[model samples]
Target: MEPKPASASRVEVTHLVMPGDANSLGTAFGGMVMQWTDLAAGMAAMRHARLPVVTASLDQLSFLAPVRIGHMAILVAHVTAVFATSMEVNVEVSTEDPRTGERRRCCDAYLTFVALDDAGRPTRAPPLLTESEDERRREREARVRRASRLALRTALTGA
Candidate 1:
């Protein structure tokens, strides 16, 4: 069977921070941000793969700022790269203030997800159809990001 098709636009998911999702300081926990990352990335992956998918790896996650209780956390995910059975999804998390409705970036990450079959095994994803200049541009930019990641990894491991 063929894989499903990815959306040309982004998939944005939003969550509100309640008491349960906070830390002792009443700020959102990093683990919670990570969980949202996986969820948003998986959605983007499903769009890219046209099938159910699972996280293969999270290349990097950086928390730039803290999210407070009563803040609205939004995740925006987009397809960054596509391989035979996997696709890289980039997710950005931002927080909106409750009173003034101000928004600020909180975190960003790159996650790779692999399509799965009914048995929950890896399966081939659909080839990305770049129908617009924007898609081509995004793919190119993703390649650059991937190269930068590899270089950084090599430097860190001295490999």
Candidate 2:
């Protein structure tokens, strides 16, 4: 398959934070944010591969700020790298205050997804073609993160 540019599969999603999405402290729940990030990342991966994809792992999920209820949660995701059947996706989440129209990054996450065929088996994904210096840097960093994840898995599972 021919390599595709990361921008081709980039995704941006926005959600309104309601009371149900928040905790008693009036801030959005961590799990709710994670769910949104995962969905955005999955969409990016599926768009990149043009096949069904499943989340294999989520790493480096950091919650930097609290998003209060009534804020708009914006998630932007893009493929960072592709390795055979899997792809790395980076999701950045920000919260926008409707009244002031101010936006602040609240969360960031990196996720790995595996493309699947009709038979539900892992399928090869197209290689990623980074277009800018920032994309290239993200790809290089993804490689290091993948290496670390592999090392940790091996150490824990002896596989």
Task: List, residue by residue over 1-159, the lDDT tens digit for candidate 1.
Answer: 443334663689989999899999999999999998889888788766668998766776678889999999999998866877778788889999989999999988887788899898888877776667876787788778767765886888886
TM-score of each: 0.81, 0.97
Alpha-carbon deviation at 29 in model 2, angstroms: 0.6
lDDT of 1 at 57: 66
On TM-score, the leading prediction is 2
**Local accuracy of candidate 2 as per-residue lDDT tens digits, 49-120:** 999999988996778989999999999999999999999999999999999999999988999999999999
CA lDDT scores, all candidates in order: 0.81, 0.95
- In model 2, which runs have C-alpha deviations exceeding 4 angstroms? none
Off by over 4 Å in 1: 1-9, 131-134, 144-159
Model 2 pairs in collision: none
